[model samples]
Target chain A: MALHPYDPVAGAALRNVPLAEVDSKDRSLALSRPWQLRPSLLASIASHGILTPLRLRPKQNGLMQVVHGFRRFEAARRLGLPSIPGLVLASRNLLKLFLQALEEGRTARTLSSLENAAALRTLKYRFNVPEKRLIEEFLPLLDLKENRRTLRLHLDLAVLPDALQQALERGLENETALRLSGRPEDFQSLCCRLILSFQLGKNRQKKLVEMLDEILAAASKQEVQSVEEVWRELGCAALENRADLTPADRWKRILALLRQARYPALSRHQARFDELKAALKLPPPVRLQAPRYFEGSSLEISMTVREARQLDGLARELKRISGSQEWEELFRLL
Target chain B: MQPYKPEKVFVERAVAESVITRNVLGNLPMAQVEWIDEAGQMVDKSRRWNPSIARAKQSLVLARHPGRFFKPCPAGTTKTGRRNVCCNYFVVNFASNCHMECSYCYLQAYLNLPYMVVHANVEDLLDELGQVFSSNPRSHYRVGTGELADSLALDSLTGYSRPLVEFFAGFTNAALEFKTKSNCVENLLQLDHRGRTVVSWSINPPTVVQAEEHKTASFEQRLAAAEKCSAAGYPIVFHFDPLIHYPEWEKDYRSLVEEIFQRIPPRSVPWVSLGALRMPPRLKALVRERFPRSGLPLGELLPTEDGKLRYFKPIRVEMLSKMRAWITAASPQTRIYSCMENTDVWQKVFQSQQPPSEVELGDSLLQLL
Candidate 1:
C-alpha cells in the first residue's frame, strides 16, 4: 500500500490552538520509541527553553500529528508546559508539503546518509505514519514501546554472513543501495558481490585478524571495566576496521545497503539533515561561544591547521587552539 | 492485599554439622564439593529454620531457611522443574540469594533475605531425593534447587551445583534443572551428566543487563557462557519468566530472542518457557516495604486460589502471546512451553490442551542423557 505523509491544514491562523480546543478522544498519539531521548537535549530544553516549535499535521481526528520534534514536544509536556507551538499540514498534499518542510528546514541541502536515516526514522515514527489499512507498513509498526534503536554490531551485522549489513551496523556510509530493510536477497547479493570481492590476500587478512584480536581483547577488557567505555572503544574499533575501505567503497556499499535500511528515505530527506547541518555550521555571531578547552587554555577557538594539529597532539588541546586564528577560520568554514 | 506474613518460617535456624559425602561409584567425576566450614554449617534440623512449604500435599524440605521473610515463591511449573516440566514449584525460603542479583531476576523481592550465612546441608535432602528418584526412577521426579538460591549461588565458594550435577548424573530416571541468573559455572563446566542436568539461565535484554539486572554479566556475556556450555556439548535452556510487561517489551524481548537464536542455535535450546509477573501474598506486602518504589507488585494485583496475586489469566495470556510470537519467529523448532500454567491457558497460548505427561517429557530428556 502507498503511504503519503500526513498533510494537515497548513496555515498561520490554525497554528497555536490550546490543546483544549483540539478534540482528541479517539486519536492515538504518534507512535514512538521512548528510550531514544537524549539527556543533554532534554537538559538544554529545561534550562534554556525550546527554541524551535514542534512540527505537526492533522490526522483523521482533531489530534495533532507530530510532524517533527516528537521528543521536544514530549519534553515540553513533561516540563508541564500549558501548550506547544506546531505546524499543521494537509493530508492530501503530504509528499509536497513534507519536501517543502524539509527545504525550509535544510536550506544548506547537503547532509550525511546517517543524518538522513535518522531523519527518516524520526519522520516515520515522529511525523508521517502509514495509514492503518496499508499492508506490511514500511515503518515497523511500533506501539510506543518498540524502539528503532541502533543495531548491535554482532546480530544486525556481524552475526549475518552479509558484509553489507555488517558494514551498515558498523555505521559505514552506504551510498550504493542505502536501503534500510534487511530483505534477504539484498543482503545475500551484496554479501556475494561486494564483501567477498573485498577480501585481501592471506597476510593482509592476517593483519585484519590481528586487528580483530586486539580490538576483541580491548572490547572484552572494556566489557569488564565499563559498558560505555566498551561502546566507545568498540565504536572506534569498528570505524578503524572500516577505515581501511575508502569513502567511495563505503558509499557504494551503503547505497547497496540502502534497500535494507531507512537511509534512502533519509537521503531524500535533504531538508531536515541540511537544517541540522546548517544549524551546526552557523556561528554564534558573537565572540564568546561554547568555550572549548585545549592546550592549557579554556577560551574561544581560532587556530591554524598546524596549531590545531599541534593542539590535537596535546594531552589537553582544546584550550590551546580555541582562540587561535586557525580555529576561527575552521569555525567560519564549518 | 493484607500487608505480610512469612510463608515457611523457622523460629530457629538449622545448624547442619554435616558435610556432603562423595559416593561417586562410577565414570562420572566426583564433584569438588565446597562446604560451609563446620562453624558455618547449620547442624540442627530441630532448629527453627525448618523450611518445607507444601506444594499440594507434599511438604518439600529445606535444612536451613534463610530469614529473608516475605520471600514470595511465585507459583509456576517451569519455575520448579526443568525441561518441558509438569509439576508445581515455589521458593522454599529466600535469603542472601544468588550472590549476583541478575538484573532480570524476580528475586529482587528476595533482597528481604538476610544477607550472609550460606544454608549448608543438603545431604538428607539428597537422601530424600535419592529415595524419591530410586523408588520412582520411572516416576520421573522433576525438581530444581535453584529457584530460591541460584542453584550454583555458592557453587564457587560452596561448589553446591557440582555435587547435584554429579548426583543427578546417575538419576537418568529424573530430570534436575539448575536454574540460575548467575554465570558462575566454574563448578559445572567439567561435569559429564549430558542431559540430566538441564543448565539454564534467566535472560534479559542487553540494556537491562547493562542497566537494571545490576552487577550480573552482560546479555552477550551470559549468552557466551551458555554458548560455552553448548560448545562443550550441553543442551541449554532459556527462561523469560516474569516477562515484565514493561515499555518496549517488544524491543527488549525481540533483542533477547534475536540474540538467543544468534548465539545458542535452535538445536541447543532444550526448552524455553514464557511467563508473566506473579507475586505471592507475602511478597506483595514485603517488596512494597523493601522496594517502596518497586512498581511490580503494586499494580493491579488480585488474589488467586493459590493465595498469590497474579495478573488475571487473560492479561498473562496477552503477555505470553507477545513473547510466544517472538520465540515462534526465531526458533519455532525449539520446544516452547508455559511455566506454572493450567489447562485452558495451555490450550490457548501453546495450543496444547495439557502439557505431555512429566514421565514422557522426562523420557525425552533422558534419551539425550
Candidate 2:
C-alpha cells in the first residue's frame, strides 16, 4: 500500500447545491450525531443563508452526503432555502473524509463530550481503525489521555441511551455517567432520573451510584436481582415518588434509606448510640460523640463554652453523666 | 500446587555469575533468558506495561539489590504513624514479588516492579547480617523473609533457604523465620536448622484457600507440609493473617484449628497470629478490576483511622476473639496473638486493659519456646 499525501480541504471546488439533493440521513461518514439545529445556529443561517459551505462528497447517483456541516444543512432545509453553498471533494476514502470532518469540527469549536465519543466510535467501528491506534494515535488527537480506560469510557459513553446522553448534556458528570454505563438499563435510567431531579453535585452523584451498586451486590446473595427491587424492598421507591417532599429532602431520605440498608448492623449500633446519648439528657453546648465508625476505643465529649456561667451547667451535666448507665452503655458500644 | 515456570527471565548483568542466579536459570532450562544491565532501569522503562498482576508474575527478574537487605517490619506502625503492637520483627527482603496470586495481596498495590524479582546476591545479605549481629552481641532479633515476598515460594528454584537456615544456625541471639504459603519444605527436611530457624505458614480455611488463594498450595497440602517440618524437629508457626469475613467463617476457621492440632503435635508449634482482612484503599479497586467474581469486596468494609479498609470494629473484634478461643481450645499451651492490631484490639481479645510492648511480645514468644 503506497502512502499518499492528501490535503483534506485543498483543491475542493465550492458549489451551490440544492438542499433536496443532499442526504444527511446517511451518517456513515459523519463524526457527529445528526444535526442538532440550535436556535442560534438556525437564526444565523436563516439570516445569512449558509455562508460557510457544507462539506460534501458526491454519491454515485448524482446525490451528495453531508460530511461536516449537518447543522448548517439542517438549518437551510428548515428555512425553506432552495440551495446552500457546499464544497464537493474528489477523494472517496472514508478514513480521510472522517478525519477531515473531525478536524473541521475540532477547528470550528471544541467537540462536546458526546461528539468526542462519536468521533472515536466512528473511527473504531465504522472506519475499521484498530483500537490500539485509537488509544495511542487518535486519543491524543482528541486531547484525551492515551490509555485503554479512556478509550473504553468514550466508546461506552457513545453507546448510552439518548436520554442518558441528554442527561449528560444537562450536566450529569462524565465520570458519573461512565460509572453508570455498565449497569442495567433500568438502573441507569433510575439513577439518571434521581441525579437530574435532585440536581446532585458530583460527590452526591458518585455516592448515589456507589450505594446502589453495593446494595445490589449485597442483596444478590439473598437472591435479589435488580436495583429497583432493592429500592422497593428498602422502601426507597415510595420515598422516591413522594411528591409532597422537596427533591432535596427526597434525595436525603432515599440516600439515608440506602445507607441503612447497606450497613444494617452499623445502623443499629448507631441508633443504639443515639438513643443512649439522648437518654443521657445532656443540655445544649454539650455534645457526646462516638468515634468515626465506632472504631475507637473511647467516646468523645466536648462542651462549647460561650459564657462563664454556661461552663457550670456543662460541668454539672458532665459530672452527672459520669456515673450514669447511659455513659456505660456508650462506652460499651464503642 | 503448580510449579512456577516463568515465561521469561531477565538476569541483571551484575548478578549473572551469582550462584542463586545460576541455580534459577538451571532449573528454568526452557525459559527465554535475557541479560540486562540494570533491573531498576528495566523497570523504569516498562512502567507503562499495564499487564494484569497475575500475568506480570509470569516474568521473573534476577537482580542485585542496591540497598540494605534488612529493615524493621512495616507492620510495626500503621500508615498514619500510629504505633501498632508489632512483634518486634525485622524483615529481610530477599525478593520483590510473589508467584502465587492472592486476591487481597497488598503487593498488588505495593510493588512497582511488574516482574517477580529475586535478589541474586544472597552472600552479601548473609555478610551484612553477620556484621550487624557481631556489632550487637546481646540484642535478640526475630527476622522474617516474607515481608515483601513469600519466603519459600521460589525456594525450589533459588535454593536460598538452605544458606539462610544454615547461617542462622550459627547465631544464638537471632531467630530466622521462613514464612510462606507454599509446600516447598523438601529442602528444609534435609537442612540442619539448629532450632534457630522456624518454618511459618500463613494458613487459611479450605474455602478461603480455594476461593482467593490462586495457584498456591491447598490447605491440606500446607497442613501436610507443617507435619513434615514438625517431624524434622523444626518449630512450626502458623499465621492466620487476613482472616476474611463470611457467613460461615467461624465454622470453617474452627475446622481449620481442629485439623491443625489433630495432625501436628502441639509442642512443636510455638505461636499463632490472627489478623482480620484489611488493605489500603487503592487495593479495593484493583481487586474489583482483577477479580470481579471475588466476594472480598462484598464485605461491609469501612475505612479505619489508619486509612485502610477493614471490617467494622465490632465485627473484627468478634471474629478475632472467636478465632483466639478456638485456637486456645485446640492448643491450650500454644500462644495466640493479633497481627497489625492496635492496643485496643489486643486488650479486647486478651480481656485485659493493658497490651504488651513490642519487645515483650518478642520475648514472650521466646519464653513460650
TM-score of each: 0.40, 0.91
Cα error, residue A266 of model 1, in Å, equals 40
Best by DockQ: 2
Q: Which stretches in model 2 have alpha-carbon errors above 4 Å?
A: A1-10, A19-31, A35-51, A59-63, A74-84, A90-110, A117-164
- The DockQ of each candidate is 0.01, 0.66
Q: Pick the candidate with the highest TM-score.
A: 2
lDDT string for model 1 (A220-309, tens) is 433553433432333432432387788556535443332212122323333332443344433333233321111111234353344555
Off by over 4 Å in 1: A1-334, B1-85, B88-96, B100-119, B210-212, B292-295, B298-305, B354-369
The lDDT of each candidate is 0.49, 0.86
Q: Write the residue-wise lDDT of candidate 2 on B1-369 in tens digits.
A: 777999999999999888999899999999999999988876765665768777888889999989999898988778788877788889999998998878999998998887899999998999999998889988788899999899998999999998999999999889999999999999999888889999999999999999999988999999999999999999999999889999999889999999999999998998989999998978987887777768887787888877898888899999999999998999999999899888888888889878888888887886665
| DockQ score of the complex predicted as candidate 2 | 0.66
What's the C-alpha lDDT at position A176 in model 1? 25
lDDT of 2 by residue, A1-334 (tens): 1112343455577788888888757767654554345889889877777777777888887889887887777778788899988787777786787787888788879888888898999888888899889999989998999999899889988887776788898879988898787778888988998888889989989888877877787777679567777778899889989989988888788878887887777888999999988998888778878889998887887878889888987897688778989888888987
